[model samples]
Each structure stands twice: as structure tokens, then as C-alpha cells.
Target: MLEFKVNSQSQSVDVDPTTPLLWVLRDNLGLTGTKFGCGMAQCGACTVHMDGMPMRSCSLPVSVVAGKQITTIEGLQSKTAQAVQKAWVDLDVVQCGYCQSGQIMSAVALLESKPKPSDEDIDQAMGGNICRCATYVRIRAAIHAAAAQLSA
Candidate 1:
């Protein structure tokens, strides 16, 4: 039995240690907020916070995260997350919306790490997250707006 705390909930699943955290979160736990884009870590669609750091869940094995605190979009309650979410909504940063959750998660992590991230910081942190709808401009704007909200 592999166990981990997800979204602040203590949960356990009977699965292979090698199973990707994506499938476990989606199939086993039914937390569908984390989407699977590219199975590789490049896409960042499955991004989730492991111990408050953004990580790609699609490629990470469940075993590696055992006993770690995993926070998904649904469980994000930090001030940064709230500010990012508000900025996302206020900026209308979603196109098709498939990638917005990951974008928001990544933005939340960025804001937490650098409350006032510059363009370079936003680009570096969000570079791995690909938006099929090409919402990069809006995403960056939202991140900045979130920082502003946080600073105030």
C-alpha cells in the first residue's frame, strides 16, 4: 500500500510503486483537476505541488511521493493561490480551459516563490507549461496581476 497526503487528505492506494502519480490521482483518487497532456514532464499539464514545489505528476512515480504533501488545484488554499486564481479570473486567462488548471498551479507556485516575478522569472517558471490555445500572453499578465494583488 502506497500512501501519500493529497490535497491535505490522508489517502492510500493499492498500486504498483511505478504507477505515475497522474493515473493514481485521476483514476484511483478521482481528482481529475490535474490533467494529463504529454506523458512526459515537458508539457506541465499535470503539474501539482509536491511539498509546495511544482512537479509534473504525469511522469513522477507514486512511490517517490509517498509521505509527501501533494497539493492539487482543488486543494490550493494559500494566499498566493487565491491571488493567482483571482487574477486568472479577472484577466480572463483561459481559452479552451484545458490547460488553465496547470497554468494556474504553475502561476501559484511562481508567485509563492517570487511574489513579484519579472517577465524573465515568469517565463522561466512557466516555460515548461504549454498552452495548446496559445494563451501565453494572458498567462503572463495574470501572473503579474497576481503579484500586484499579493503586494497590496
Candidate 2:
């Protein structure tokens, strides 16, 4: 049995220690918001916050997350996350919307760390996430807007 905290709740799960967190979240915990883009860590679709830092859940082992705070899109309900979501919607940042959750989560993490991120910072932080529809322009704008909103 492995113990972990998710979305402020403590949970105990019995499963393979090496199993990816994505499957445990979706299959066991029924938190399906975290998606699976690439089985490898190449794609950021499975990004989640482990102890408040962006992490690729697809490559993170369940054992690694044990006793740690794991937050998925479902848990992003703070003022910061709300501001980011509002800004994303205001700017219409999503195209296909497949990767928006991860994108938003990543942006929230970024803004939390760097209140005013430059283009280079945004690029460096968000480089791992891929949007097939190529909504990068809107994403950057939304992040800036979200920062402004958070500042207010």
C-alpha cells in the first residue's frame, strides 16, 4: 500500500510501485483530468504539481509521489488558478483544448514562482508542453494577462 496526498486529501492505494501516476490517478483515484499525451515525459499533457512544482505525471512513478502533495487540474481552485483560468478564457487560449489543462496548470505554477515572467522565461518554462493547434501566441498573452490579474 502506497500513501499519498492529492488535492489536499490523503489517500492510500494498493498498486505496483513503479506504475505511472497517470494510471493511478485515472484508473484508481478516478481523477481523469490529468491526460496522457506521450507515454514518455516528452509531452507535458500529463503535467501536475507535486509539492507545488510542475511535474510530468506520465513519467512519475506512484512510489515517487508517496506521502507527497500531488495536485492535478481538479485541485487548481485557488485565486491564482482562477485568475489564470479567467485569463485563458478571456484570451481564448485553447484551440483543440486537449492540452489546455496542463498548460493552465503549468502557467499557474510559473506565475506562482515568477509573478512577471518574460518571454524567455515563459518559453523556458512552457517549452515541454505542445499544442497541436499552435496556440502558443494566445497562451503567452493569457499568462501575461493572468499575471496582471493576480497582481490586482
Candidate 3:
């Protein structure tokens, strides 16, 4: 049995050590908010927070995160996360909604690290996350709005 903390809850699952954390989260833990985009980690749809850092869950092994903190979209309750979510909604940033969770996760991480990120910083931080709807402009705007809200 492998033990780990997920969304502030202690969990134990019996699975292969090499099993991707995406499956472990979606299938085993029923946290489907962390999507499966490119299984090779090219897409950021499977983004999640490991010890407060955004990571691609699709390519990560479950065993590697043992005893570590894993926070999914459903459990993202930080002030930064709230600000990001509010900005995303207030700015109408969702297209198909398939990739919003990952996008929000990445945005929250970026804001937490850099509360006042410039356009270049946002571009650099969000480079790995692909939004098929091409809502890059809206996303950037939301990030800025969220930062502003946090600053206030």
C-alpha cells in the first residue's frame, strides 16, 4: 500500500508504483478535475500542485509523490486560487472548459510565486499550458486581474 496526502486528506492506495498519478487521481481517488491531455506531459491539462508547485500529473509516478502534498483543482482553496478562479469567471475565460482547470492551476501557481507578473512572465510561466480555444488574451487578462485583486 502506498500512502500519500491528497487535497489535505491522507490516502492509501494499492497500485503499481509506476502508475501515472493522473490515473491514480482520476480513477482511484475520483478527482477527475485533473484532466488527461497529452500523456507525455506536453499538454498541461493534467496539472496539479505537488507541495505547492504546479506539476504535470500525467507523466508523474504515484510512488514519487508518496507522503507529499497533492492539491487538485477541487481542493484548491488558497487565497490565490480564489482570486484566480474569480478572475477566470469575471473575465469569461472559459472556452470549452476542458482545459480551464489546468489553466487555473497554472495561473494560481504563477501568481503565488510572482504576485505581480508581467506579460513576459505570464507568457513564460504559462508556455507549457496549451489552450485549444486560443483564449490566451483572456487568460492573460484574468491573471492580471487576479494579481490586482490580490494586491488590493
TM-score of 1: 0.98
lDDT of each: 0.93, 0.93, 0.96
* Model 3 lDDT, residue 147, Cα: 100
Estimated TM-score for each candidate: 0.98, 0.98, 0.99
Query: Which residue pairs overlap in candidate 1's backbone?
Result: none
For residues 1-152, could you state the per-residue lDDT of candidate 2 as single tens digits?
99999999999999999999999999999999999998898878999999999999999999999889999999998888999999988998888999988898899999999999999999999999999899999999999999998887
Candidate 1 local lDDT, 1-87, one digit each (tens): 988899999999999999999999999999999999999998889999999999999999999999999999999998888899898
Q: Which window of 10 residues has the lowest lDDT sum in candidate 2?
A: 92-101
TM-score winner, 1 or 3: 3
Better of 2 and 3 by lDDT: 3
Q: How high is the lDDT of residue 107 in model 2?
A: 93
Off by over 4 Å in 1: none
lDDT by residue for model 3 over 1-152, one digit each (tens)?
99999999999999999999999999999999999998998879999999999999999999999999999999999999999999999999998998888999999999999999999999999999999999999999999999999999
Order of all candidates by lDDT, from best down to worst? 3, 2, 1
